[model samples]
Target chain A: MEESSLLPPVVLVHRPPALDFIDEHLSRHSFTALYTHTSLEDSLQDFLSSHAASVRAVVSLGRLPIPAEFISNLPSLEIVVCASVGFDHVDLDECRRRGVVITNAGDAYGEDVADLAVGLLISVIRRIAAVDRYVRSGQWTRLWDYPLGFKLNRKKVGIVGLGSIGSLVAKRLEPFGCIISYNSRNPKPDVPYAYYSNILSLAADNDFLILCCSLTDETHHIVNREVMETLGKNGVIINIGRGGLIDEKEMVKCLVNGVIWGVGLDVFENEPEVPEELFGLENVVLSPHAAGMTAESLNNISEVAIANLKAFFADQPLMFTVQLD
Target chain B: MEESSLLPPVVLVHRPPALDFIDEHLSRHSFTALYTHTSLEDSLQDFLSSHAASVRAVVSLGRLPIPAEFISNLPSLEIVVCASVGFDHVDLDECRRRGVVITNAGDAYGEDVADLAVGLLISVIRRIAAVDRYVRSGQWTRLWDYPLGFKLNRKKVGIVGLGSIGSLVAKRLEPFGCIISYNSRNPKPDVPYAYYSNILSLAADNDFLILCCSLTDETHHIVNREVMETLGKNGVIINIGRGGLIDEKEMVKCLVNGVIWGVGLDVFENEPEVPEELFGLENVVLSPHAAGMTAESLNNISEVAIANLKAFFADQPLMFTVQLD
Candidate 1:
């Protein structure tokens, strides 16, 4: 109470040392820097002991894991304002047990992510990346039979999750004449798009499966060999969601064996380390986990994150509060 | 008249021997192939003198020039069913003088071409092809600073022509929150998008310029250096129209000197021989004149071409008659 009257609210940043978004932003709050390039165990414990009690909120960035042990260190943490749509990195059970409210970037990233999803879908289907390669390599002159690509029109697209991002993807794709259906934990009551209760069923029915769900225990490896097999040879997968949503090993096998037509992945299970086999594959379009890496989207997320922190401090209803279920 | 009772209505196949769409699909008519691997002039004249009188229609394919000489050879030429969206290669003045009606593939290739236009636009704006190269080249692991791409949402897009393909591009971009405008001979009454009478104004105001016009006398080199300079550093140009629509030499210079942000070209001024300068550019996404090469669109075009031919023979109204103007 004495500190609140004299000083700004203390906010702790939980991300890698290089991720300076919270350091650069969150200027209004007295954010503590716990990152150390070396001697992490010693310095982190020392810093936590001295400053953890004063930290009222944490600004999570770059999907750094906020485990239970880390949560226990922050005894006075009242809220966590995540700067990403996916807050799976944070321990939901620990947050709920400690009575800490959580708010995410919400719809701040929906449009950009959805835009990339549609872009990837089009890229893979139309063989844009592959064709660019063909043209760049001077193959178009030598090869008369330039590969014919599939059309996006009237293609059945099954969204893995019909959340904010998925909904936007559906809306953007509708004008492209894509038949949108979705699979979620529970069917959205207001949406006109057909809902599938299971991922397997959704995969079996649709020509393309777009992974936009949060990476949870239930969702991890949700798209396995069986689902891919059901999606068949013409099936294309677009993962703008977490990489863990699909079994990376099985996916590589499927891709190599021609079990699936193509894939457009923005994320990978072992990110920054994509499968070497995929490099030569013309059918696949790989991205470096950059679906939400737009200037506008990043700015939006920053604003949303700061807004949530301010709302929490003001004792107002926070925007984009995550239901810890 | 006696031969008409004994055989099918005579049609002339005017295309390279390799492009076999007409030969494979146009079965109902008694068509004559005038292409010879060697001595095209002498053999073509011999073939024309022997069989040209009976040919009532010339099936123009692959943008092969249907010159007045060729048209005059077939004195009985009543119609030209072009198996392509653009009938610019056919001499319009010659057809107008001879009162020979021309029918094009029409809206058959509209959706596919529009889809590719949108796809190329997204690929260029988002740096999808470049990012894919980054990832595939294993640069993401070494370089942490992945290039940020522009968002499609709220982007100001100017379509060079608001015909079937352009209109469809506008429609597809609307749900992405793009503010669409266009430049055409005349403003479309049905569309809600703003219209610009000139190309310069359209290029100056819009963030992205999509060329979807025909290659004609007035439209040749429509996107010149001045138009591109007006587009400025943040602007993107997507050419799904004929290559002649943009001045290729100037475009290459603009791209090299950063006059404009980037370009996504499906057509080149001298295609299959893309400017070597564009090979090194990261911002551009080049396709080898394959925007309308989808199987579905090809089938659609084939059906429309056949339908137009049938309607012509049956003395019914043509499906997609090209007004000689």
Candidate 2:
């Protein structure tokens, strides 16, 4: 094969240092690469107009929203690679229609997300946020009226999704002396945790149910009124994954009625605008969707995104190609 | 020994359900116990005035500030047993001058305080407080660029004062994959942690230096500028024992100048009033002297307090006796 035809030029639209890794790897393979650091709102037309002739693919980390018009305009763009797991911002159908391959950096943030998940779990169960607020407000003249928060040790933890992130959550919780049980599409390999085939069954048996699975048509709002009721009055629900995986209204009702002891939510059904009712509740601990926002996860996502982009251009097996029929 | 001659009437300042254990234990003897949920400020005078003839000693939970005048008034109060480790609130010198025996619940709250010490250490290092704030503030959007928190795994943790709480901290940190080292007056038993034997040397070698020893005359202001300077820029100092263990003025200067990565303080020299300067600092996490404020600890303290009171009255060996020369 001729060297000229062997490799194609690629453009990465993410942050540098991470892109530097891709640049270094691609240099070894004799491929021409153009790196562009652009914001999501910036006109992609300018970049396409300047580098469309040589740009074979675009690897992005929130630099561009893969819209239908953007996909159609990039004549030479063969693939759109996201440096993150969530593809809600991408126009997947349009990319499929244009025959532009889409890949995402999935499971790259599993450990980081899982760490946040367990951290949130411990924070909420231990009433750390409430205690901190009390101390900060100067209301801690004496010991708190309520008992110190409960320990995570020996509590039964139910995982809603036993995917990579869920498995990692289990691994972290395991050291805390929790008995782990998980609900998923199918049972995972030789794991130590007990697998529950149903969410309600899992919730009933566990003190906490953590949401770590992906949001899909089948998994959407999997935790509803029945599941919350099954989780009982002593149960806590922690959602570090997509908010759509839980029913917010139902959760509020359960929380208010003491069907659940508390909730720690990092992701809500709607971003930025969360339910105002969740604000003052001492039992609830809420975070803006930032469970996977650690620096380590960012680096992991960026590295994975670059590798996927590099692998696609090299005609090798791409790490995380999104299937499109 | 004659049972009636050996027995004495005791007055309990505060009574909880756990006192039943002590009552039951003492019932085997011939001691007369009078329990009351008295207000420390006013009821002590009334109880002493009414029961001075019958009352032989007083058992307390350390909630009452036993003044010298009150001790002078109690003609029948031969011993004052405190159900807490710290006896600073009590007039120890007064007791010694008046020939009144004083016993403190020293080892009772050890495990509980140790638990809180480890909890604060993990909470601060993992950015649990900040993350909780982020969630409740409703500003959670991108996980990236929010906070660059680190995991507790694979870090060098130094403990000052390898006493009960210090040893417990080491045990807890051991499971979290941290290399534990300590400085103490004397080395501890068969533990795997490296004993530094010197405070500055311990702080220099570790990522986190936790103050868990006593704040005696010798250990007061041990974590001063020179020791902190040895800790360098990447170090974190946690004070869970006493505020006097670290010089707050020097700590503020170091924190402002980035001399250390962060500080987690459960105890302050003049707390319930935290230094106003520490309020806005992003590197520090503050608590209002609550390292031993867990519900379990409270119950444990109360139970042990009752036991000590009962034991003193029955002429049995008191569980925790503070010696006064």
lDDT of 1 by residue, A1-325 (tens): 8656366777877665445655556664544444432335566667677777878888887777788877898888899888887787899999999999999887777788898999999899889999998899877762345677888899999999998889989999998899999999999999999999999899989999999998989999999999999999999999999899999999999999999999999999987789999998999999888888787787778778877777777777888899997
Per-residue alpha-carbon lDDT of model 2 for A1-325, expressed as tens digits? 2763555565645443323334554566545656554433556577666766666677666433567766666777788777767766777888777788888877766665776676677667667667777766656554334335665556899998887788877876664567998998888899778888889888878888999888899889999999988888888999988899999999988888888889888788976668877887888877666565555556667567667766776688987788876
The local distance difference test score of each candidate is 0.85, 0.72
List, residue by residue over B1-325, the lDDT tens digit for candidate 2.
Answer: 2553555565544333333334554455455666654344557568667766666666665244667876777776678777667877778888888787777767756655665566566566667677667656766544233455666667899999887778877775665557988899988788778988889888878889989888899999999999889999878888888899999999999999988888888788876668778777666677666555545555566567667666665578876677876
Error of 2 at A189 (Å): 5.5
Error of 1 at B236 (Å): 1.9
DockQ of 2: 0.29
RMSD of 1: 4.0
lDDT per residue as tens, model 1, B224-285: 99999999989999999889999999999999999999999999888668998888899999
Q: Interface RMSD, candidate 2?
A: 5.0
Candidate 1 error regions (>4 Å) = A1-23, A26-58, A68-80, A92-102, A142-144, A310-317, A321-325, B8-23, B27-58, B66-80, B92-101, B142-144, B308-318, B323-325
